[model samples]
Target chain A: MSVNARTMSDDELFYGHKACPGCGGALVVRQALKVLGKDAVAALPAGCMSATGFNFPQLAFANNAMITPFAATASVLSGIEAGLRAQGIKPDGCTVVGFAGDGGTADIGLQALSGAIDRNDDVLYFCYDNEAYMNTGIQRSSETPFGASTTTTPAGPSHPGCVTGKKDLFAMVAAQGIPYAATASIGYPNDLLKKVEKARDIRGTRFIHVMAPCPVGWGFPSSDTIALGKGIVDCGLWYLAEYEDGRFTLNRDPGRFASVADHLRSQSRYRALTDADIVTIEAHRDQVWQRLRQRCSCESS
Target chain B: MLEVIWHARGGQGAFTAARVLGAAASADPDTFALAFPTFGPERRGAPMRAYTKIAARPIGDRSASRRAAIVVYLDDTLFADGWEDELAEGGVVLLNSKVAHPDARVVTVDGSGLAADILGRAIPNTVFLGAIAALCDAVTLENVEEGIRATMPAKLHERNIAVVRAAYDLVAGRARADALPCCSEAAPIEGASGEKEREASSVVSAEPPARIIPQLQELTVAPERFARSTCFQGGHLVSKNAGWRSLRPLVDQQACTGCFNCYLLCPDGTIYKQPGAGSSSTVAIDYDFCKGCGICAKACPAHCIAMVEEGGGRDEALHIRQ
Candidate 1:
């Protein structure tokens, strides 16, 4: 069945845990699990989802789930898949999946993820990027965007928030010629669900980097999580794209990008972003999109 | 020694208040105090406890206080029956509530309202510090001011000091007027059993102690439980999350288009599709697990879901609307 809003199963696989109200990471896990079904053996590293989901005596995952080492989310998924295959107990339609945060994936877990892709392990890896090390009180990560305020990269009169641009994780992964990879966000649930379902069917290594906004760390009202998720994409700060079989596709090409300043001002994390910083961000975005339009098959509105 | 317990939701600054109170008491040259918080790795809005102990000499034990001379409730929704049990002999429960309880042991204070008026936000933690200043002999308002200076940043001190003074005056005036019931004249909780019926409309568990003890027991199971650490029961819930919500979403089913936008977007997955007449379906919220993020209400394309203040705590609504 097509995983859309109306046809989506009502059965909740991720519930009863203590995630913050309007947690985008929690939504990413819940929606992805729904598509993967009960048969999916899940692994999560030390991030917001794992910390909030795996409280003793109050385990949130209805399906089989375990916490992986901080930097070993992908490696652990490979191990789980191999172990299940060796035991001949791997259920049909069972997809070995890993949910790691931005730091876990882009920074620490990048090596293991690269290894998994190299070996072409039959696993689905999800990097729920909240843009920083949110679980550990909003520290800077490789995936943390330029001019975003984090504990390590404090914004001040003299110092701009994060001095570096967001790492090109999709390009990094796609460079390996991985079987399937997609970029998703909590804002577009339908698109996210579709991508998750598609990756579930793929046999070899699959990765979906989902933009999950953290309301507490991001300095927005909890209710704005979905809005911010959508805003980030609509504002052209984040993109919707996929990589499959040496082919790159741009799912969304918002020809006229929304006000990047408005989006930045909505989040206090970008409160210190000067006009120059915004112009710099826009320039970087244009540069990246220019490259994407050149190389990828762009979808015309 | 004066031991105090603070019951609050996560991110509510209970620990900060506790530390400030401790700092206030320790301002005396001979006095020593310690403050700390205890909670699982639960995120914001989860219920947690903070403790403060003050004594004349150096304290030896660093364990959590089982009983306290004062038990302060930062959120009145956290108040449950048998709250009196946590109190030491002649100790009172300082509750941040506008609703007056008939029990003399429970002294209700509109801390959220007072703080919201002054600070433009409902931060009741420091308000309780002011009440502690007026009611307890251990710390005076001057000491509380010193505590605020020591604990909070310079920009925050002026306003927080104002809040602390306001709370002190409220409690002090009531005490002087002989309107505030003395804890020594404690009366049994008049509606202890009757309150159960009222609790259903809200998330406050009618019998929290009953559920809490067993959960604690499960945590400390001996190593010889014969099995691995894996929990077989999927979606095991230790407690209902109704207490987390300050605002509740009320859905008008007639206007609902079954869009599933609210259901699909809810982070907690608390919104469920209830099959309606024929093939049509409408979404309903499972308040037991709903963290009251208001996402579902906002996501509702039909504008059917309205975010209303959760039932009870009418006073909190007044300040919130302000």
Candidate 2:
């Protein structure tokens, strides 16, 4: 019913941008901006969002944005934050946001993002995880889950999909003892917006890992980009959590977890996932969620 | 060899058009045809050319065709860009043009519009196969239908077949009408028999104007650059992103609720919020930037944005965007 119809205000984005229909990163950015507000600058690396979201002569950003190298989003935003200081503008006054895709964050930009987080750079790094390198036509990335087919990791007679599991990017960020780290999804915009606002107010390297959908790369109808993401969260495949002040917070409680198999069936990429593969993925997700819950309980102890 | 050259933007089904025609020609007992693209920068909306060769005997030319018996233009803008150099003497031109090219032996069909009308989208790939079949004696309409039947899904075959037939009959009917030179509407004015007579007399002069060939610009390429992913490193966006789409998204401000649903899911960031779009900031679609994926239409919560089948200038026969 009317999700986000109340707080709709003047967007910091223009029309006539060239993104494909049902792009999850587009949704994530639009939602994130509602919290980040107008006094924020975006540092985007080459991704699906960077490719179709902005064009030459006229770009899509209504805020001050810079297109950085895929591995250099954090580094570029670091420079921008420092540059803002030279002009006597408080770097903290304006949020320096680094927007990158899963591959860019987990693989290529990992070094830069890690260095920024390690040094506690004044930036809100957002890795809108579409799970693969979607802009270059659905190639496999570190963030892509196991048993999901991609152009590089083709599912065939011997292969079901990707053989390896997805990288634990949130754990990696939280392990650095960063000021703030969290996971969110477009399915829950209220939670997503609140987290973005919290990160906007907090200083140091704040990270928001978003499980955004990819219609073309993920082989789903554009209309299902949002709807399917809800299933992802509902099935406990993607956990909504935050880590700060040495405390773990689970945003969504799985009252009853849906079978991950039931969720994967809708995705064409994971269509080849066998019953056994589904069992393995569900078991693994359960183990991860159990460990995360244990870490969350440490707050009470 | 009956060489056909197709001038279109990238991802506009140029290769598909070539393949369909080639498959249709190959249906014959003794005929063989080959289709391939003359690749440029491989991105959306780049000016691209695809060649099809149909021959009664074995053919060997692998190089791009310098001369053609027929030049079929998939995009209307390429005709304005000048493609006559590829056309050999007595060559016929077939294109999706609103106005028929009378000066040259040409057959014009509103294929884009026909495809949109019949297929619910403006891709016109299979429709041209019928137009080609009607214009060329080599492939029969049955052969083209067979090609369409083979290439498309069972659900789509009937619609595409009908649209292709409509194009074939229209062009074939128009050719016959012009040959007879019957004036549908005649006005007696001074010694002029009718507007038809004026049309016949006003045919381009015997010594037509000389063709203007644009000078070739020198292009330099680095072989090593192809190995890396330049897109992640702020690589150059050389090609026009807009030209790649056959269907374009146009925002209906009156019907929009400023929900930003289209602006959210657009992968290309082609949709932006323009000020004064009504009570709220409604979205704007940049034709030069949109890739015609129709995701915006699917995501429109207000159901106002229409993914109109654009290109080929056949809006009159286009179906309402669903």
> B1-322, model 2: which lDDT tens digit per residue?
6788888888778887788788887887556678899876678788898988876533445667888877878777778635667677667677876767755566677778888888888876676777777666667899988987776678988988898888888877766433211111111221242334336436722453332111111332233222211221122233445666766776666677877766655555456676654366777875655676676786777777666666533243134533
- The i-RMS of every model, in angstroms, reads 5.5, 10.5
CA lDDT of every candidate? 0.85, 0.73
DockQ of each: 0.27, 0.09
**How many steric overlaps are in each model, in order?**
0, 30
Q: List the candidate 1 regions with Cα displacement exceeding 4 Å.
A: B1-232, B277-279, B312-322
Q: Residue A14 deviation, candidate 1, in Å?
A: 0.6
TM-score of each: 0.63, 0.53
Q: Model 2 off-target regions past 4 Å?
A: A1-3, A90-92, A297-301, B1-322
Residues A50-93 of candidate 1 have per-residue lDDT tens digits of 99988866778878899999999999999999999999999999
Q: Which window of ten consecutive residues has the lowest lDDT sum in model 1 chain B?
A: B209-218
Top candidate (TM-score): 1
Tell me the deviation in Å of residue A178 in model 1.
Answer: 0.5
